[model samples]
Target: MRLSSFFMPTLKETPTEAQIVSHRLMLRAGMIRQTSAGIYAWLPLGYRVLRKIEQIVREEQDAAGAQELLMPTIQSAELWRESGRYDDYGKEMLRITDRHDREMLFGPTNEEMITDIFRSFVKSYRQLPLNLYHIQWKFRDEIRPRFGVMRGREFLMKDAYSFDIDAAGARRSYQKMFLAYLRTFARIGLKAIPMRADTGPIGGDLSHEFIILAETGESGVFCHKDWMNLDVLKDAPGMEDDLQPFFDRITSIYAATDEKHDPANSPVPESDLVSARGIEVGHIFNFGTKYSKPMNAVVAGPNGESVPVEMGSYGIGVSRLMGAIIEASHDDNGIIWPDAVAPFNVGLINLKSGDAETDRVCAELYAKLEAAGLEVAYDDRDERPGAKFADMDLIGVPWQLVVGPRGLKNGVVELKRRATGEKEELPVEAALAKLLG
Candidate 1:
């Protein structure tokens, strides 16, 4: 993509309303724009990153044996009533009435609706251990929505519902989601620690919140220092395998959100404890028959007895992750995007855009990079070198290739790594090889 044709409206100064680094940077970088309080319109650059994160979450869910299906944003109030939560869900639920005088709502979550779906077609234990998920928009009317997309009232989410025949099967489903969440976050270049957390409105005894530590996090957390060393993806268990041991290894460590932490009851010594602020990126719940039982989502057992299917729900904040990642990864310059989620793999900078030699070199490099299966954003506008560099850094492509008349005359160009701020002067061929490799 060429910057000359791109529609990134970057700002030179920080917006006064942005209280966090992620919020401020996102605005200054022209990734998103606020349409209302706690709601945003994702600009071109922002949408690219959002889709990348969504794909990662989708891939991991598929790997864990979960099937994908999209659900609607608007839900019937009758479904919530079946689960006995329509009245109890409080003001956050965006209740509305259609012209036909039927009550409706923008779903904050899909537990009730999914249960209704299960009860409709799934009749016997033959379809047990089924998992269905979707990536869709959700809305919750937050009383005080702030911090940009981090606390947005409207956001994108990936919610997966798992149905099993018994408590044992439910636990296995939960474990698979647990492992899947770990792998999903890692692939996005985040080290998310799974910590025991409150189920909140989801109403589950077994729950875990995947948190990424950041100074701008919304909540405090305590965990063992050893958590930093564990790689849940290494030698991961297959979907059909018994995941008990793998689950046990992760939950054995001391980890808790501030709401669940008890210093006196902690198994890890205080000397070995590491406390930090963390942003919640994903959550999973093993809610037995919470939704199924209330909604009468029953299936026939092997013994021919009617039983409510045990169920679990897994959620990853698809939109909120953009903010969480920025909080954890950005520097004073701007966002340093991870390679897997970056808007483009490389930024091609022509220091002298109108110069015949510089333009020729950059155009050639851009074509080579794109042919190598790379996403390149070529800065072809007639802008100052400093402005071009600033914009590239602010948008946070992983690598930047700088071409100028002087460098072209010398038969060399500069390659810079965004994350490490490392630079190397190499021949055009050498730079292409390094980037492709």
Candidate 2:
């Protein structure tokens, strides 16, 4: 994509409402725009990042033997009523009434709806262990929405519901999701610690919130300092199999969020305890028959008796991750996007857009990078070199290739790594190879 043709509205100064670095940088970088208190309109660049996050979520879910499906954003309130959670769900639920006075709501979560779907078809124990997932928009209507997408009212979440006929089986399903969450966060360049969390409105006896350490985080957390050294991706397998050992390896650690933290009973010694702020990015829950019993999500058992399906729900904050990634990866210049989720692989800067030699080199390099199956953004505007360089760095596209009169005269171009700000002067061919390869 060419910058001149793109819809990025780069800002000269930070927006006043943006209190956090991620929020401020996102606005200045023209990634998203605020629509309501917590709602945002994701622009082209923002959408690209969101889609990359969705892709990673899909890959991890698929690898964990879960099937993906699309669920509607708006759902009937009748389902929630049947589950006995209509009034139980507080103000966050955005309730509405259509012309006929039938109540509806933008789904905050999908426990009731997913339960209805499961009970409709699978009546036998043969289909007992099914995990269904969807990546969809949700509205929670936060009263004081702040921190941009991090605590947004309307956001994207990857929620997976698992059904099993027995308690032991349900626990195994929870472990499967536990392992998947570790792999998912690791892929996106975050070391999310799974700490026990209050189920709150989700209403599950068992829950874990995957929190990432960030200075602007909402909740306080306490854990063993060793959590910083545990490498999830380093030990994950390439393909799915029995994940018992993987699950065991992570669950062996001691971690807890503020709600669950108890210093007296904690495993970590006082000196090793690391107390800090953290952003909750994912959650896993084992709710037993909370939704199943209320909604009659029952299945025939091996003994020929009908029983409420033991259940679990898992969630990953899909949109909020854009903010989390920035919080975890950014430096003073701007957001340092992870290579896996970067909007573009390379930023091709034409130091002098109207200069024939510079334009020629940039155009050729841009085409070559695109041909190599990379997402490349070319700054082909008749803008000053400083402005072009600043915009490219602010957007954090992994790499930047500067084709200027100086480099052209020397048969070289300047390549800069967005994450490290490390520049290398190399022949155009060498730079292209390093970028594309």
Candidate 3:
């Protein structure tokens, strides 16, 4: 993708309302536009990152045996009524009345709707452990919506529902999601600590929110420092296998959100009471029969007795994560996206755009990088070198390749690592090999 053709509307000034770092950078980068209060229209560049994150979330969930499905944004209020949450959910639920005086709503969460769906088709314990997930937009009527996508009223979410035969089965399913969430966050270059949280409106005593520490975070968190050292990839619990190891992995570290952080019975040493502000990017809950029982989602047990299927819901903020990643990985320059989640893998800069020699060399390099299956954004615009460099840094592509008449004449191009701010001059082929290899 060339900058001249890209739809990014890079700004010269930050929007007044964007107080948080992630929100400010997103606006300055021209990634998103506010369509309404707390609602945004993702521009080309923002949508690219959004889709990339969603794909990673999908891959990790699938690996954990959760199947993907699409769910509608608008759901009939009758579903919420089934669980007696229509009145209990409060104004946070975006209630609506149809033209014919029928009630409708933009779902804040899919627990009720998913339960209705599960009850309609799934019967008997023969298909006991089933997990279904969907990435969809949700609407919540936040009284004071702010902080850009971080606390948007309308946002994307990946919610997965797990159905199992018993409490034991539900715990195993929760552990599977627990492990998957750890891996999912790690792959995006985030160290998300799973902390126990208040169930809130979700109504589950068993819940954990995957949180990343940032000064801009919305919630307070306390945790042992050891969570930073655990690696899900190495400590593979094979999510489908025994969950005891999975349970042990999380138990090895003590973590909790402020609401559930019990100081009286705390396990961590007072010296290790590392408290920080954190953003909740993902949440999972083991709500045994919280939905199934209320909605009558029952299954026949081996003894032929009717039993409510235990349920759990797992979530990854499909949109909020984009902002959260920016909060964690960015610097004064702009967003330093994790290489795994960047809209593009590399930024190819041509110092003298349209200059015969410079153009020839950059075109070849861009072609080579693209042919190697890399997502490279070539800065092929007729802009000043200073502006080109600033824009490149602002977008925070992992690697930056600089081609100029002087450098190309010397048979080398300058390469810069966005994360390290390190620069190297290497032969074109050497740079290509190092970057693409």
Candidate 4:
């Protein structure tokens, strides 16, 4: 993509309303723009990152044996009523009435609707152990929506529902999802620690919130220092293997939000405890028969008895993850995007754009990089070299390949790594090879 034609409207100064690092950086980097209090329009650059994160979540869900499906954003009020939560869900739910005078709502979550869907076609234990997932937009009317997409009222989410015949089967599904979340965050260059969480009115001990530690996080957390060194992607068990040991190993790690922390009775010693702030990015609940039983989503058992199918709901904040990533990865200049989630693999800069030799070298390198199956952002605009460098750093592409008349005359180009701020001058061929590798 060429910067001159790209629709990224970057700002030179920070917006006063943005209180957090992620929110401020996102605005100045031209990743997103606030349309309302908490609603945002993702611009070209931001949209690319959003889609990349969504794809990663989708791939991880698929690898865990979940089938993908689409669900509507608007839902019937009758469904929530049947699940006994319409009245209890409170003001966060955006309730509305259609012209037909029928009650409707922009769904905050999909438990009730998914249960209704399950009971419609799935009957008997034959379809047991089924997992259905979707990536869609959701809305909740936050009283004080702030911090950009981090606390947005409208956001994209990936929610999956798992149905099993009994508690034992449900536990296995939960374990699979547990490992799946670990691998998902790890792939996105985040070390998310799973901590036990409250199940709320649904009432179950089988609940966890996956949190990533960041200085700008909202919730204070306490965990074992060992969590810092554990590489979940390297050590996680296979999806089909016995996951009990892996599940136990992860849950046994002393990690808890401040609300759940008990210092007097904690197992970890003082020296090993790492108290820090964290952001919750994903949550999984193994709420047996909570939605199914209330909504009468039953199926015939092997013994020919009617039984309520055990259900679990897992959710990952697809859009909020963008802010979380920025919070965890950015430096003073701007966001330091992870390689897997970066919008472009490389930023190609023609330091002297009007110079024939500089343009020729940059264009050649851009073509070669693209031919090697890389996403390259070529800055072909008539801009100053300093402005080009600053913009490249702000958008946080993993690498910046710099070409200038002086460098071209010397038969070399400059390659800089965004995250490490390290640069090397080499022949154009060598630079291309390094980027490809």
lDDT, residue 127, candidate 1: 86
Instruction: State model 2's lDDT.
Output: 0.89
Which runs in model 3 stand beyond 4 Å of their true positions? 262-265
Estimate the TM-score of every prediction.
0.99, 0.97, 0.97, 0.99
TM-score of 2: 0.97
TM-score comparison, 1 vs 3, better candidate: 1
Q: Report the C-alpha lDDT of model 4 over 1-437, residue by residue, as the tens digit.
A: 88989998989999999999999999999999888889999998999999999999999999999999998999999998998899999899999999999999998989888888899999999878899999999999999999999999999999999999999999999999999999999999999999999987545568999999999999999999989898765676799999998888878988999998888888878789999999999999999988888899999999999999999999999999999999999989999999999999999998887888888778888788888899999999999999999999999999999999888889999999999999999999999889988
Off by over 4 Å in 2: 233-242
lDDT of 3 by residue, 262-353 (tens): 88888878677788889989989888887887789999899999999999999889899999999888888888989998999999999998
lDDT of 1 at 381: 91
**Model 1 over residues 1-437: C-alpha lDDT tens digits?**
99999999999999999999999999999999999999999999999999999999999999999999988999999999988899999999999999999999999999998888889999999988899999999999999999999999999999999999999999999999998898899999999998887888999899999999998899988989987787767887887888999889888888888887888887879888889999999999999998998899999999999999999999999999999999999998999999999999999999998898888888888988999899999999989999999999999999999999998889999999999999999999999999999
lDDT of 1: 0.94
Off by over 4 Å in 4: 201-203
TM-score of model 1 relative to the true fold? 0.99
Candidate 4 global lDDT: 0.92
Cα lDDT, all candidates = 0.94, 0.89, 0.89, 0.92
lDDT of 3: 0.89
